[model samples]
Target: MRQAARSYSVQLAIIGSGMAGFAASVFALDRGIKTAQVGNTGAVAYTTGYLDLLGGDQHSLLTDPWRALVELRQHEPRHPLARIGEQEIRTALARFTHAVSEMGIAYTSPGETNLMALSPAGTLKPTCSVPRTMLPGIEAMTQGAPTLIVDFDGLKGFSAAELVANLRDSWPELRAARIAFPDLPPGQVYPEVMARALEVSTNRDRVAELIRPLIGNAGAVGVPAVLGMHNPDRVQQALQQLLGVPLFEIPTIPPAVPGIRLREMFEQCFPERGLTLVPQQKVTRIDLTDAKLRLSLRDSYGEVEILAQAAVLATGRFLSGGLFAGRNGIRETLLDIPVTQPAARSEWYRERYFDRRGHPLNRAGIEVDDHFRPLDAAGRRLDPRLFAAGILLAHQDWTRQRCGAGVAIASAYQAVKGAVEVIGQGSAATRG
Candidate 1:
């Protein structure tokens, strides 16, 4: 028998597994390009699951994310979001959100105005779109309808009382309750386990039984987002029908159900749809000198290789090992690409911790050209076949601007668009 094949060829290679990397693969697949995605899949789980556009500035929140995008272009033209036209951004976000929905998790479409969504702690956050399971909470809070927010006894990080305490002023009818998780171990229960357990109908039934009695006169009942890891929509619907009221999920905390659902959904669905998903492994080396770019990394079995016509570098920021910070300065981890950062490490941050300008270090990353190709030190394209996306691109601090997911999806779209152009015709011909 032949040994397991260790090498594959594709039209596009995506170099990260975070939102941007995943978005690139989705867009490529939509374009009918053969694609492969490889990266460590941890950071996606740490996200709060709110897809923010230009939700706010350092000082205050913005009602109109599109309007914010317009102003962003005027001031920060180099910002990744600002560089892409609004319509393109809109289309890209809608496509990404729709693709994700089709994969499994249902999401509200991006709208004209940002929705004021709920945070784990009772504070409201302006976001472009939210998971379907969490939409009812936004609706309940906006209407000031009587609602009961419940938490499990041993669950950590999410507190029903904390959410209500902070939100009571705005939504006085909002109340809080805590109950023991049915059949859970005695101590330190996690949201992941709870969510997975909820995949079973009996488990959902046990939860609904406990929540129904406490939801008296409430228009909706909200619970921690442990509504089934695989099919949250089904689990949520079942709970709602059983409770006789609208049901919603509140974001628990980072590394909680919302983000886990996205990562898991990709793992489950991407392979079946003709996408090569290399989960939880780093691409050790990339060779771009050849016409067909080559990427290599080792798995438990042995060395694995991918040959692609074009590649997108969406390896996120420092946390995900996309950028490395050292004694000299920060550098792109994968290709050692030019990093646009402060002159010295001393200037990385402001003298004060909360300076409105944010840290200069946050703005540092590989700069990309109009087509999203990584630019060299003299601002020339590093290689026509290589492009960059996600937080690793320079000139904007995504965290403070509230455009992380927006940047990821939009840049991935543009990068993949550029890659498709390159794939259809040689980069030299496209340039010519």
Candidate 2:
């Protein structure tokens, strides 16, 4: 392959490509800001397509997530969501879901109450919004509608029988079956491969034909999230038409179809929308000065440099390599930004792994101010041009609280807003 330009310039540079990083870029694009996003689409492919906003805590599930946010702010004032206004949080999440739906893979808009969707393990997930392809599942489970759930012959980790056995008490009408994936050489079947195959019309036809005979008097069909990778909503529509029933998807194992669809969507859509995207690449280092921000990274061809007026650090937690937990303590990976963690390693966890209160180590992350700017020991912003977002901001555990997507999307909005302000002030100084 040939080499491209070694240097580029933009008004804003986003440091990660997880939900937060991608959300920042989307927010920037909406404002017509020239933006460049560089990093792996991190931790995103490990998610279900559902967008959650404070689903619940460790003890109880919250039906009214908005009301729960009010309580959350009072108790956890330093939480990232607490730092943001409720209206802003609502608008930011709504705008993000709308943007992605327009791009592809339609998502239901965030609403007042959390929607109950089924997990691969047959547990109910209380999320704010879910993909339209999976929305039928909520209705099917709630109404006890006769739904036939199918698992593949070779696909592992998702067992239709197990799902039915677990949910039988609440949903007695649920039935389980299995079918062979059509037209492929397969030792082990993967959701990603099955999804891409379904993208072909013939494959959809075959799948629907196979599923139709099994759906005796059933009103709906649920399958492992093996809907078409690129066009899931349309694929669901076509298959439902063929089977004469409402069709929906249940989330599969991690690195499953839902996350894969999103990762591919960002890679394909970002560049088309005039956002400079270096997909699947990470920034080696970032130099933030009083004057400007410089990001350096290397790709397959060669090294590349990016200069921008402002940057958003949304690289995520240890799973994404944004924070490193050393034997001594946890350290921020990219900028060496201070992490607000327990003083000693011994304080990291509790005696019980399933402790309802959760572990302190889960809350370890950087601290940020009202404007989403990371702060120093003195509670001062690290730099006028730097901001942080997502799970990397301290105070609450995303997994336990069920606010991962909310924190990522809302904080990205505030971070991008701060960056825009910084960039605009710089432009004003040039005019002056």
Candidate 3:
């Protein structure tokens, strides 16, 4: 038996639940726009919880992202970050981070210089903003303070010894320790389970007791990012109080706790603020009308529809199913939008795997105009009310450049602003 299709009407419909989609919802909410967002679990959970804003160019790591933006504009004017002014990008990042903080995850304010954030592999990456809980480790690493990095007995992927070995030369005082998580039956430990368990005061106390004995002369302790999922700042602080030392987290491998924390926080908080969120569902079809845009999808209940005055496509690249790679060519999954890509698959990659110049395929994406509107092959706007943002936009390699979150959030802000203007104009015309 087929269930009848359910429907929702809103001023804005955002497709994609990644940083770009979430940022668009935040921007729209600030402007009092009614919004409904739909997307399957995307690459948001793969994030390190670091908001990178133009970390560097291909040649070297950037110290000052603002200065790099100037160089980027001169060299890669077609790049999405170059298309938007620095101030607008700055404002967008600030607003998005601020909202996330307000929603229970505390993040450091974006600064002029990129923070040397710790990665799961013990490498340092230049990032604009970090979770407040992870900030102490950045400072501890910078100062070469005596720090103890602890790993759980059964946790995979994060080796405290490996991190210490890689960083020992740079940070002579760094040390590593392994401890058992409180009350866990272990063959392998999962970060999500440890993070949730730590939310309980007794579990936090038990873990803190184990870490306290291993601290030695270290001034601070670093652990994999398994601090409480909902209130990490509170958990970190509570554990820090018990251990009597500053504590920070190093990012764990993908499907990491910090990324999960952000996803869960937004999912829980967005609805409270009036967003009609359709979490973990992909929009199967879209219909564009002169008056409104209609989106179709399915949930556990069956068919669902979303009608909106404007739509923002934050659908991410290859991994997120926004862009599909065919044997013949790369393609935009939805709307059959023309993608700006290399002529052939052979042209996608350079001869060398680690070529600094990057591959042509990395730059393949849907083309957008000045207002962030998706453009057709003939350079015409596909729809005035349809806008695009995030990694799906053409030009610039996000991975090599290390500007994924910056491009996503900043472009989403611009797209939402454009959508607001279009919707407002439409409303005025109807009243006339």
Candidate 4:
């Protein structure tokens, strides 16, 4: 493949293909600024795609997401200022829904929280909301007290009977059973499973068909994590028309395709506007100068260099490689920026492997300013022109709070907006 120009005049270089990268590209492009997007793994592979505003109860974080940050800030002082509040979180969710919808992806709110849904493996997934496409209109059925757990045959990674037994331990009085469907793979790799399902089946309709028998028997219909097909609108219509019960989705296994699909939509939309997409290209070095910022990227084709007036580092956490770890422990990838975490890696976790309480891995992330710029050990900004977004610049635990997507959106927006201002001011200086 032909290499990208060795040196080009670009206004901004947004790294990572996740929400933060896509959001930054869109923001920069909207300002008529030239930008390039490069990253290793695309964010979609690990994202749930739903418009996550505040994870869990809005009221939980509303009173203070900053509480954790406030304490950490005194120690790290460089940690990014979290702009999320109860009301701001609400507005951000609304804005996210509108933005993605305008991109032609339809979504609706489930209006409930801490609900349960089914995974393809016939297991229970306690996802955040009803989700636009999957949740059922089962409230009426539940009045009769029918609780249905939807299932898919041949799905790996979970057991339906185990799920029911677990749920029964909690709500013994609610009537619930597993309903199976066809067409899912008996054994397949995660991505292949996702690609096949996206191509051949309608998860929504299959879920509806399975729950149809229990329509009146159960007041609510729960589906495997694969409840909705890739199409949100179709999933919604199917659930609405099928069982007259409420529907919910759950997290089942690793490499969730539903999450991947959502990420794909954002990635595809970015290039349509002329945003340069460099997949699997990892940035090896970053040198910031008074005049511009320079990046050296390494890929299979070898080293490809790029320079920009400003940059957005959205490469994500250790799992994504945006943050690096070794005997020295975890540190930010690009600048070796200091990270806030337990001095000993052992301090990073609770005694229980799955404590559900905050994990050290979640806390081990970069510290940034209110505008999302990384800071140095001295408590000063690393680069005035540099900005960090997404999980790379961290504060809260996304998985526990269920605000992974929310953090991605809020920080990505803040980074892009800040980049535009700095780039615009620099451009005017050069023209002068």
Q: Give the TM-score of candidate 1.
A: 0.96
Q: Whose TM-score is greatest here?
A: 3
Worst lDDT run of 10 residues, candidate 1, spans: 1-10
lDDT of 4 by residue, 172-213 (tens): 534445544455445442433533453344654565576687
Tens digits of per-residue lDDT, candidate 1, 1-432, equal 545549988889999999999889889989998899998865788887889888878788888999899899998899999999888999999999999898889999999999998888888888999999999989888899999999998898999999999988889998889889999987899999998898888988888889888988899999888898988998999889999999988887887788888988887788898999888899988997886898999888888989999999999998899999999999887788999999999999999887878889989989999999999899999999899999998888877887889999999999999999889896466578
Given candidate 1, what's the lDDT at residue 201?
85
For all candidates in order, the CA lDDT equals 0.89, 0.91, 0.93, 0.62
What are the clash counts of all predictions, listed in order? 0, 0, 0, 19
The digit string of per-residue lDDT tens for model 2 on 1-432 reads 766649988999999989999899899999999999988857899998888899878779889988998998899888888888999999999999999999997999998899988999999888998989999989988889999999998888999999999999999999999999997665678999899898888999998889999999789999999989999999999888899889999999898789889878988998999999987899989887647799999988798989999999998999999999999999999988889999899999999998988899999999888889988878889898999989999997998888999999999999999999999998999799
What is candidate 3's lDDT per residue for 1-432, written digit by digit as tens? Answer: 767799998999999999899999999999999999999788999999999998867788888999999998999999999999888998999999999999999999999899999998789999999999999999999999999999999999999999999888899999999999988997899999999999999999899889888999999999999999999999999999999999999999988998899899999999999999999999988898647899999999889999899999999999999999999898899898999999988899999988988899999999999999999989999999999999999997989899999999999999999999988997899899
Any residue pairs clashing in model 3, and if so which?
none
Candidate with better lDDT, 2 vs 4: 2
Displacement of the residue 162 alpha carbon in candidate 1, Å = 0.6
At residue 220, what lDDT does model 2 achieve? 91
- Compute the lDDT for candidate 1: 0.89
Q: Kindly give the stretch of ten consecutive residues in candidate 3 with the minimal lDDT sum.
A: 283-292
TM-score of each: 0.96, 0.98, 0.98, 0.76
Full candidate order by TM-score, most accurate first: 3, 2, 1, 4
Error of 4 at 261 (Å): 0.5
